[model samples]
Target chain A: MDFATLIQILDSTVRLATPLLFACLAGLFSERAGVFDIGLEGKMLAAAFLSGAVAAVTGNVWLGMFAGIGASLLMAAIHGLASITFRGNQLISGVAINFLAAGLTVLLGQNWFGLGGRTPALTSGGRFEPIILPFAEAMAPVPVLGPIYSELISGHSFPVYLAWAMVPATAWLLYRTRFGLRLRAVGENPAAVDTAGVSVTAIRYAAVAICGVLCGLAGAYLATGLAAGFGKDMTAGRGFIALAALIFAKWRPWYALGACLLFGFLEAVGNRFPNIDLGLIVLPAQFMQALPYILTVVILAGFVGKAIPPRAGGEPYVKER
Target chain B: MTAMPKWADAVLVPLISLLIAFVISGLVILAIGENPMEAMRIMVSGALGSTYGWGYTLYYATNFIFTGLAVSVAFHAGLFNIGGEGQAGVGGLGVALACLYIPWPHWSLALAAALVASAVFGAAWAAIPAWLQAKRGSHIVITTIMFNFIASALLVYVLVNILRPTGSMDASSARFAEHLRLPRLNEILALVGIPFNNRNPANISFLLGLVACVAVWVLMWRTRLGYELRAFGKSEKAAVYAGISPVKITMAAMLISGALAGMMAVNTVMGEAQRLILNSVEGAGFIGIAVALMGRSHPFGVLLAALLFGFLYQGGAELALWTKIPRELIVVIQALVILFTGALDNMVRRPVETLFLMARKGR
Candidate 1:
């Protein structure tokens, strides 16, 4: 209710929303390219574990991030091989990837670290440090805008800023570029795009690779930026939440930012207040935690509006003779 | 659709896929500095060598049967019902209330009441998503997945506030009344003059699972509703043209699926734990997806797939207990099975089909 609490809540929202933002944007790319990826959670988990393990060993956050991205890209490649190359069921492939990630992460983690599927906590240099923006100290004297700028915007790890910046970058790439036009076309009507001399498979693989890169950043952020180490299933259900946000945002980059922030705000509030007493009725923390999923279901049910997916989504495009 | 014989299509493909998965899993074991052959021996001996092992394996199989059938039913209606985890969790609430509050004179009577209660609760939980998909055009996969989370949270709230015994730190209810406890499999076996592992948790619910499998087979193949459900799943527009209501079929299929998922509570809650606890369903709901897929969504196939998974589960536990193989590797193995049999079926099928076609041509 007070200013400090409000600022704290907003700050937490920024931190929590960063991963969701990266993942939502990732899903946006894949889905917009006609791949229904439910394996985002698995990819993120793999990256999180790899990043944390590599960071613990090398003591370099950048190297850790590279390893994380490499790991995620490998997973994306496997998904591509199964779904795109083999022309298999995309959903089944996604589920397999998820299962593989969940198992392999813990198995390898236990093998290497022996701390029960968890990497050792990274030291300062191994993790992403918060960046204090220029003039933050001097601007502290200013009343309303000062603390907001310094506390809320200034001191986040690099990925937070990268994720925020990616919104526009994604928008530009998705709308302003020729590749974007083809990608959207591939998702909606691949036959038409194929007729135009475009290779649907190449475009789809590119989209999935881009998705892998973003998911790698998101997973790296969770381990190296936010949590310092990776535990088993640390990404939890955030990938699914990101998918929900993708649907909630209607597969748009800008709307994904809003949906991620909203979901993040809900999580922050739930963490801050275990039980909310509003003088009349008390709300349980579990209710708050469950709110996003409940809201997603409501939205998908068309209580809010219709969320129509790409026409060619989920089906492997078959070229006609 | 293939020139291959039905036996080869049904049996040969899955056997080859399973062999491939196990071979890959064996290599993984070797990578972990363990003997692959030794691990296989241990897994088999631990899961089936003793009565104790069989008890646990059957217990796990019982849970899989219920959840697998749930997925198979929904698959028939072309719905991917991934909310089995949540549905089973809510079903536990039904089991808890029935066992704790009702003064059933016998376990049989209590089991009957709990069956209906759990089914109704699970069906109710799945109804919203089914309705949304049927009417509002919402994707059932997304809604059902979201519902799984909601179900977990709801169960937690109920257990923490209402079901937890007073002054107890555990997020579990007090033990159910003695009369409500289902008979363990050992007791039933003893009546037939056979010795069994008395301490093992395998219970009469195993029989219930078998019955459910038969029931599902009859419903899916023998009943008119099953015809309509399958018809709708094959092609919705065609079904509509044939005068079958998509809405009714979707709701019916989902309801039956939820009910089957919910029935898993009977095995975990009344048969084994004898009380409601958080995480009672574990990941059986997700495992059901793989089971259903591997089984080709057929009841008989589901039964075999469930037993295979049950073996892996119980064997994985033993491996963890005695060997260096982490329990999570079993999940990797299961995932590989699913990947080969379900996702990459064409990889093997194509080669085999070609072989079969060549053989026919030679003949």
Candidate 2:
């Protein structure tokens, strides 16, 4: 492939993968802290609606970002209260959150905006623009990879950078910091953490809240970064994909990025294959559409070998009655 | 002023949960400028309006019966089979393929071929998660949820390309032959002077559902394998100590659940439809979870809850036609039922069990 084409592919891949990376890390945080966060999709959807609404009205992208995070925090708080505190079944609670967000968003969106299924398209003035660093742009003059650096790597919204940088930050936070230790401890053995004088509930709440924050950013990435407007069901099971990434990554923050990139590549290919014309390469657009999920099942079932979850993963911790 | 017995928990809990959900839904109805009282009344009448309505309601109930049994079967074996959606979807795909691709001279042959394909495909889908959990110790929850997405994508592909019916953008398929369909039960009932004479396909699936429910009860309570599955559910370690192979039980449970869900393909796709179509599963597999939960994982309880869901489905559609309120209110109500039932404490369990027993005996 030509350098320009390669650059285009890389640029598109990063832009697409950004949302998944944010979501995977979000799941990573919650799961690592022992709270199963299956409600990330719900949190993201709710935030996406709120973010677009705020951005459209005030025309302040930053305010919309904050609003998105705030909306997701509220969702995360509900999950925390139900699952971590009340000891509700995580799966049920997660499903409830999804149902609630889906119903509430449509209801309120229909009432608030006259639009049927989508928000009014936002202008560039309300979107987060891609930032190109001077040094990266300077690399464009060379022959072999210059176009790749300039066209592919240099341009993208802030979240693209943040998603990459969050890996190390999450890695250090998860492995290097005291909070990380407590979070891992809570997930591994809540009782042990409790005996060590750490409040398992509080740690879990914090972890889940962080997950919400990242999910919100991911949702905004879908709207402002990917499509520039909020579409009903736009998240479209991306949250579930993130969950798959978390599973594939075995709940590690750093590895989660790799997993997301793989999924992102699969998704990019699904979007890309419709253009390529070849015998045996031709799949119905819908089958191509489902390729990622099919791959996820295959991977989880056997293709990716075995995955080991935390010992105390699905169990709620409570002091002995 | 007498205190309720703790043993009445099951029945009481679901009832209380409904009361709470109604309170919440009432607030929602108020927000939309409709009277909650009028809305609820409209909903009830819409669901139970005519004999034909009951037919439609029965039709909805029949699918849930198979799907609910699918969910409960796994619960009885201590495996949460969340791949109901995927398995059902796959079964539907198989049925659609058989109906369209099989060049049988007779419709009965096509029907038989379609049904067999559906059962086999559904069983295989369920087998994947079972294999993962049984052999690899993979969590069924994550794997099954992943399977749902995979199923959606795979179905979309088949619907759009391979199975897409002529002159349709909706990713639907061509209709199966008329002879391949289940004969109208309303007409048969009409011959017997039955109350509902509408020609809807809401026919014998409910009867079939009842038989299966009873069969499930017998299998679980009376059979040797049932005891083994229940033992595994209650205490895996103890069951293992007793020389029960959990691996086999887990795999068998998932396969049965998948097949049960696949049986629902008949009610929705083959039995009900004039032709094979895309996305025939219609999220029934996912809704099965609610039925299973509301039924407290009991086969008979699942039957009643499935019927209740059928009523809501009918009511939801009718409410839209007859009232200013959105039909989605019924969906909200259904969601409420799931939430309340899932959260029902011991307070609801005993009463629910008692009621369930009374219903079974009454049946």
Candidate 3:
């Protein structure tokens, strides 16, 4: 690959990885608070549809973002209600939410827009236009770092920067804040958090809500930033991939960015090179697409390294008499 | 240990949950400017009113029965095998390879060969995750979900590059030989002097599904392995104390679960399509989760739940064709059912148990 092609791939990688970064961070918050959320995919889908639908109708990108976030939050509330209040199986709840989003998004989309389970294509006014950084055009004349800064980092939608910014923000929230300490405590041992006069339920609910907000942003980015409109199952398995990225990152915020970027780069390569010729052997595009999932499985199998989830993950906090 | 009567636990809770799910589904329909009652009527007549409807319904039920049994078997061993989709997909590959490559003297022998091959393939697909869960301490749920994606990618590659006939535009394999086609249900019923629809895809695999149900029932209840599986599911600590190997049980149950899921290929690929098609399994593997949940993971309950879902599927198809309602409405209903029955069981159970106890006290 030439330098331009390399820059092109990196540009797409930044665009593609933004959604995963958002979702991985979302999972980080919820799982850190002892809630294993597999419904991240569902929430993202629902948000994508709603945001796209709203943006198409109102012709406002910000409104679309809020609509997307609201849709995700509703699903998150349902997950919270099922797994926390009812003390139900968190995985099952997550599965149901996924199905619900997959079905409801299309169903409502068809009804609202009559476009066969797709939102109407958003115009430029409804979509998130790429923000050109200061001196990007001027810097392009220089060599090496100039093109890199201009082509790869400067020209992206606001969410791209927001997603990158969130890595540091999440790291600080997780490691520096009092609420962060309490949230980590609840995930590791809710009983102790409860004994300390903190409400385990409240902390978990807050964590889940934060997760919803981040997922909402991710979905909105997919629909309004990366793509023009909402398509049926547009989120595809990105949510699950995000979950995989979370595990690959060992649930750390900064590592999540790296994992997502790695997955994104793989996706970009799959898009750029449909088939790769390795002299004696030819690698198919399907193999390229499957690489992230395969790598995740290998990571999960402990060949690379062991990934331990939160200690109190997936368990509902039950008070003993 | 029990708060309510067995019958109520078995029947009443599901009924209430189903009712709630249907009501929500109805409201969704109403929100879409369609008449919920009319939709219900259309679904009923479309899926169950005629022999043709029953044919399609039973055909779908055949797929569900196999997949549901797969989930139930693993559920008994306290493992969630959501990889049914991937397993079933790989199983189709087995069925296709057996039918396409091997020349059998008779359809019976061909089916037998295909059944074994599919089971083996499906079990092999599930074995890695099962082994990981049993030995390496990897979460089966996550691994299985990842496997689903990998399985799809594998299927796409095999179909496009390896299985597709030369010059064919579609990514499906070549059709099976005329003689190898399974006997349709109508033909089978004609021998018994019963008139049935000849056009629908329902076939002998429906009978095989029924037989698998009985086989699963026996394996789950009548066998020592079944007893150990349930015991391990109930209390892993106690089972370990009693000398039952967790690794052994986990591997055995997942393999059986995968095999059962794999058998669904016999119905979809061998019986209906008579060829290996892309996405032939569709969402039946995921549907198995809802079926197993609604049926309480029992073989008999799986049968009833499978039939119900089969009805919903057929009816929803009809509704989509005739009305403004989308076929995805059925998926929404399935989601609601899963949400209520699987995740919010205690919501209805607690209230019902209290009511039952109050009635008993009054009596």
Going through the candidates in the order shown, the clash numbers are 0, 20, 0
Best by DockQ: 3
Native-referenced TM-scores of chain A, all candidate models:
0.99, 0.94, 0.99
TM-score order of candidates, best first? 3, 1, 2
Give lDDT tens digits, candidate 2, residues A1-321: 665665666678788788999989998888888888778898888888888877877787778888888988898887777677667677776776776677666656655675754667888866889898777767889876777767777877788998999999999999999999999988889999998888888899999999999999998877777887787778888898888888778788877888888878767766765644566675565555566666666666665775666767767788755
Off by over 4 Å in 3: none
TM-score each candidate. 0.99, 0.91, 0.99
Q: After superposition, which runs of candidate 2 have C-alpha atoms over 4 Å from their true positions?
A: A135-145, A275-288, A298-305, B1-7, B97-115, B164-170, B197-201, B322-331, B343-363
Candidates arranged by lDDT, highest first: 3, 1, 2
Name the docking class for model 3. Answer: high
The per-residue C-alpha lDDT of model 2 at residue B92 equals: 83
Output the better candidate (2/3) by lDDT. Answer: 3
Report the lDDT tens digits of candidate 1 across residue range B327-363: 9988899889878887788887888889999999999
Separate DockQ for every predicted complex: 0.79, 0.40, 0.89
Alpha carbon deviation, residue A225, candidate 2 (Å): 2.1
Best by TM-score: 3
- Per-chain TM-score of chain A in candidate 2 equals 0.94
Q: Rate the local accuracy (lDDT) of all candidates.
A: 0.92, 0.78, 0.95
Pairs that clash in candidate 1:
none
Query: Compared with the true structure, what per-residue lDDT tens digits does model 3 show for residues A1-321?
Result: 799899999999999999999999999999999999999999999999999999999999999999999999999999999988999889999999999999999899999989999999999999999899999999997888888989998989999999999999999999999999999999999999999889999999999999999999999999999999999999989999999999999999999999999999999999999999999999999999888899999999999989998999999999867
Interface RMSD of each: 1.0, 2.8, 0.6
